[model samples]
Target: MMEDTIAAYSGGTLPGAIGICRISGPQAFALADDLFFPTKGGKMSQGPFYTMRYGQVRAGDGRALDLCLACCYPGPSSYTGEDLLEIFCHGSQAVVACILERAMELGARPAQAGEFTKRAFLAGKLDLTGVEAVADLIESQSAAAAKNAASLLQGGISRPIRQMREKIFQQLTHFYAVCDYPDEDLDPFVNEEARKVLEECTAELDKLYQGFQRGRVLKEGLPVTILGRPNVGKSSLLNSLAGYERAIVTDEAGTTRDVVTESVRCGDTVLRLSDTAGLRETSSQAEKMGIDKARESARESRLVLCVFDGSSPLTEEDRQVMETAQGLERAAILNKWDKGALDFPEMEQAFPKVFRLSAKTGEGVSELCQWLAGMTQGEGETLVTSARQAALLGKAAESCRMAAQSAAMGFTADAFLADGEEAVRLLDEVLGDAVSEDIVHGIFSRFCVGK
Candidate 1:
C-alpha cells in the first residue's frame, strides 16, 4: 500500500465545461472534507461511500473557490484499491490550479504519470496486460483498434496465457514425480500426453504471434510510401486519397522535392501515406537529398505504391522505379488512365497487383481503398497488439518447441523439464507474475499524468 496521498487534475484542461480533480490514498477522504464544504451541511469525511454530494470547494482562508460535486470511494473498493475522492469543478485554469495547489497544501501530493493505474497493478486490481489495455484504449485511433483494446482489457489475452502456463506447470510437476518415484510404475501414456500438451501450447502461441502483424497495422496506421519517377502523378494520388490538397500538384517534373506525409482513415484502417520526391537522377542538391530520403522511406514502409504514367511510353526512369520496388510489399498504380493506355508488358508482368486510376478524376480509387481496408480486417479476432506481449509470446513458443523436440528425441527428463520451466517463466512475465521493475516503469511511462 502507498503511504503518501496523491492528487491530480483528471479532466481536460481549462476553457472546458468541467474539470475533474482526483485524490487517491489513505488521506483522500480527510483531505476532501478539509477542502470541500457540502451543501447538505454534513462533513465529507462522514459521507457514505460511493455517494456524491454537492459542495463548495474552499481555500485555506475559508473563501469559496467554486461550486462543485464531490464523490468519495472508500479503500479496497476504489479504483486504486485505496480511498479516493473526485471533485468535479468548473473548467477554469485559475480554479483548477487553485484546487490542485490546495490539495498539495492539504498533504495530497501531485500524482505522477500513470500513478493511479500503477497503484491498481500493485494492489492486485489489474494485471500487466490489463494495464496495457487501459493505455491502448486511451490512445486508440480507429473503431477496430478501440474494440480490440476493449477485448484485451476484459482479459482476452491474459486468460489464454494463464491456461497455457498451468498446462506447462502440470507437465513439469508430472515429470518430477516420475523421476522421484522410480519404483512405482506411472502411466505409460504420460510422456505422450505431455508432448501433446506442449505441442498444442506452442501452436496457440504461434497463432497469437501471427495476429501481431494485423494488430500492429490496426493500432498504428499502415505505412504506405508512394514511389515513382518525375511527373508520374504520385503527389496527385496522395491528394486524392487525403481528400484535400496535401501535396502540390503540377505539370512540371519534380514538383515535389521532399516527402509529404499524411494520415487518412480508409474504412477501419488508417493509411499513413508518404508522398515522396520523384525517384530520378537529379543535379540539384535538394532534389538529390530528397531522392535519398524517398528511398529510405520506401525501405522502411510496409507498402510501396509505385506509380506509372499511362499516357506515355515507359522510360528508363519508370523501369528504375520498378527495380527499387522489387522484393517489397508493393502495388503498381497506372495513373492518367483517362488519357490513354501505354504498352508496358514488362511493368505489368513485374507487379502482380496493379490498379488503373486517374488521380485527378478519382476514377477507380474505390477499388484501391477497398484493398487497403481489407488488409487489416480481422473479423473480430483477438490480437496481441503490444510489442512486449508479442516478443514474450515468441519466446514462450520457442521454449515449447524445444521441449516438444526434446521429448520426440527421447532426451532425459531433466533437459525437457528445464525447457518447460523456461516457458513458464516467460509466460509469467507476460502476465505480470514475474516482470522486472524496469519493464513495468517503461510501460506506465507511456501514459499521461492523472491516467
Candidate 2:
C-alpha cells in the first residue's frame, strides 16, 4: 500500500565497490533517523535535501553496522515522488543484509519487484511506455539497443503518440461540440479536415508499427542459419564468426548431428547463429533428423548463409542446398578459399551477395561481420521496441484508418465517431492512461527487485 514505507537493496552483486539500500515512503525519513545517524549530529529531515551526508548506520540494538554515505531526497521530487533515503555503504553481503534487516525490523517493508518504478507510475511520474523503456534500457545487450531504449525513456515513442492523441481529441471535441450545441453558432466539423487529420495519424502509426520487426531484431538478435553439406566448413565458419571454437570440427563427414546455436556479436549487431547439420542424405536416423532440423532452421531464419566448398566442384548435395535456399534472404559463402580458387558461376548467379572466406584462416570474416551489422542499421528514427506498444499502435492505426474511410465516404460524424473514440482509447491504453491494474503490475513485475 502507498501508506507503507518500503526498503530494498539497490546495488549489484555482493563484494561490489558499494552497496545501496533505498528506503522510500512517508516513514522513510523516520526509518532513516532510526537506522542512520549523521556524523555531524543533526536530523537528516531538517534541511539540505538531495545532498549526501556522511553517517553511521546502526542496528536495532544500538551497535554500529557500517560507516556510510547517506542521501535524503524529500519528495514529490524523488524517483518515487515520495520521501526517499539512500544509504551508500560497503557492498558486503552481510553488511547490506544487516542494514536491510534493521530497516525492516523498524517497520519498513521489503520492496517488491519494480515497486519503486510502479510507485513512480502511480504518482504520475512516468507513462507506461517510459516504464517499459526502463526495463528495456536495463536489459539492452548492445549499443544500438541501449540508444533506442534511452530514446524511448526520454519520450521518443511517447511524444509522437501523445501528439497523435491530442489531435484526435481536438477533432473529437469539435465534433461533440457541434453536435451537442446545434442551437449555438459554433464552427461546424469539416469532414475533409477530420479525414486529413485521421489520415496523417494513421500513416504515422503504420510507419511506427512497421519498424517493430527490426526493433525486435535489435533486442533479440537476428536469427541466422548456416547451411551446407557435411564438412563444407559450416561449423568452422560459425566458430570464426563466434570468435571461438563454438562448434566441433572434424575431417569426418556428418560431424554435427544437431543445430548448434550461438549468439555472437557481428560488429555491432548480434546474430543468433544456428550451425545446422549437413544437408546430405544419410542412413543414420539421428543425422537425418538433424538434417530436417537444418532445413527448418533455414526456413525460420531471417538470413541464411549457404556455404560451399570452394576447393571442390559443385556436387549434388551442394546443388540441393542452393535449391533449398531459394526464395530466402540468403547469401553465398565460397568457403575454404585457401585450398584453391574455383569458378562457381552458378553460386555467383544464384546469390547476389557472395563472400569468399577461408573459415580456417578467418579471412574475409570481418567483412561478413560488418555486412551483417549493416543489415540492422537504422536511419536515426524512433523504433517500437516493446511488442505491447507495437500491437496497440497497430490497432490504433487500423481504427484511425477505418474512421478516415468513413469520413472520406461522406458518412455522418456519428458513423466514424465510434472508431475515432476507440482509436483514442487504444492510444490511451498504450500510454497507460486507462490500463488495468493487472497490466500495470505485470509490466513492472518484469523488473528485478529494487529497480
Candidate 3:
C-alpha cells in the first residue's frame, strides 16, 4: 500500500485493535510499497500479486507500529480490475489515522462511495445489473433481498438482456441482408416475417416492461402500512408477524405516536412493515404529525394493512380510512379474535377478504403471510430487478413502439430506423455500451469511501 492507501475501518473489534484498509487502482501496489516494509526477505513490492505477506507499517523515521498481513491483488482479476492492496493493521484510531494520512501524503485519493465497485463496472467485469446488485447486496435488509442481489450479481439480469439483444441482432441482420442485397432476398422481410418478428419483439418487450413493477417491489420490498384507531392491536400484530417485540404493544390508545418501520421476510419476499400511529384526528402536534405520517405511509405503501379490533364496532374514522384505501390492494386485519365478533356485519361483508387473526395469541400470521404471497404472485417473476434498469427498459419499449408504428404505417423509413436506433441505444445504455461520467459518479458517490 502506498501513501494513497486509506484505512477503511478503525474498528473491526473491541479495544480498537484492528483496522482494515483497501487500496485499489493502478497505483494500489505502489502505494502499499510506500507504507509496508518487510522485516526479513523483502518489501511488499517483491511479493507476487495475490499473495499475503507478514509486514510492519512504518513511519518516515521507521518507528515501529503494528504488524499486519498485507495482500496484493493484481489487475484484471481483482475486485476493481486494478492493482489492489489489503492491509490488516491493529484497529486503533491513531494507527488507522497514521496509515490513512500516510496514504494521502503518498498520493492516494480516498475512494469515493461505491468507487471500487464502480471501477469494477468500468473495467467490464460487472454490467449495470451487477452494479445495481452490488448496491442492493450492500444495503439488503432481508434474506430475500440479499438472495435477489446475489442472483443479479451473478448475471441473472444480464443473461436475458444479452439473449434479447442477440435475437434482435440476428433479425436485424437478416432484414438488412435481404433489403440491401436482393441476392439473399430468398429470405425476404415480407409481411409475414415482419409481423412475426414484430410480434415476438413486442411480446418480449411487454413482458420486460410489465416486470418493472414486480422487480421494484422485490428489490425495495413491499411497504405495508398498518392503519387503524389506537389499541387495535396493530403493534401486537406486528410483533406477532415478526416473532419478536418489533413494536411496543400497549393497551392504551395513541401509544404508537409515530410510525415505526421494520423489515421481515414474508416467505421468499421481503416485507417492509410499518406500524403507524392510530389514524385519528388529534389536537396535539406530535399526535397530528404521527397521523399525517401514517396517512402518507399508507398512501405510498404497496399494500394497506387496515387493522380493527374484533370486539369493537366500525368508527367513522375507520370508514374514512377504508374509503381512502379503496382501489388499493388491502387486507383488513381483524385483531383480538379471542374477544368475539365485531359489531359491523357490513364492514366484515364489505371486506370479505379480511384476514382474521389474534396478535396476542400468534394465530393466523402464517395464513396472512400466505395470502400476501398469493396476492404478490407472478409480480416479480419478470421484473427488471433494478430501478435504473426499469427506466431504461421502459424508455426502450417506448422507442420500439414508435419504430413498430412507423414500420406499420408506411411512414418514413428514417423515422422507423430512428426508432430502432433509439431502441438499440437505450438497450446499450443498460447493457453497457455508453453512459455518462456524471451518472457514474453520481451512482458510485453513494458508496463508502473504501469500497
Specify the highest-lDDT model's number: 2
Which is the better candidate, 2 or 3, if ranked by TM-score?
A: 2
Residues 1-451, candidate 2, lDDT per residue (tens digit)? 3899999998888899899999999999988888889999998887478988998999988999999999999888999999999999999999999999999999999999999999999998899999999999898889999999999999999999999999998887767775687675433347778889999999999999999999989988899999999999999999999889999999998999999999998766989999999999889999999999999999999999999999889899999999999999999999999998799887778997999989999888888899999999999887898898899999999999999898788676676788899999999999999999998988999999998
RMSD of each: 1.8, 2.0, 3.9
The per-residue C-alpha lDDT of model 2 at residue 384 equals 90
lDDT of 1: 0.91
TM-score of each: 0.95, 0.95, 0.84
Error of 2 at 295 (Å): 2.4
Q: List the residue pairs that clash in candidate 2.
A: none
Candidate 1 segments exceeding 4 Å error:
181-187, 340-348
**Per-residue alpha-carbon lDDT of candidate 3 for residues 1-451, written as tens digits (9 for 90 to 100):** 2223333442355346567877776667777878887666576766766777787887766776678877888877888787778888877777777777777777777766677777778788898778878878787766656777787888776787777666555545545554576554333244335435555666677777777787677777788998888888888888887889988887788999888888767776678899989878778899999888988898899888898887778788778778867877777888888888665566666574787788888777789988776654563343466667778877777776666665566554445556666766777778666787786776677666666
Model 1, clash count? 0
| Residue 10, model 2: Cα distance from true site in angstroms | 1.7
Supply the TM-score for candidate 1: 0.95
Stretches off by above 4 angstroms in model 2 are 178-189
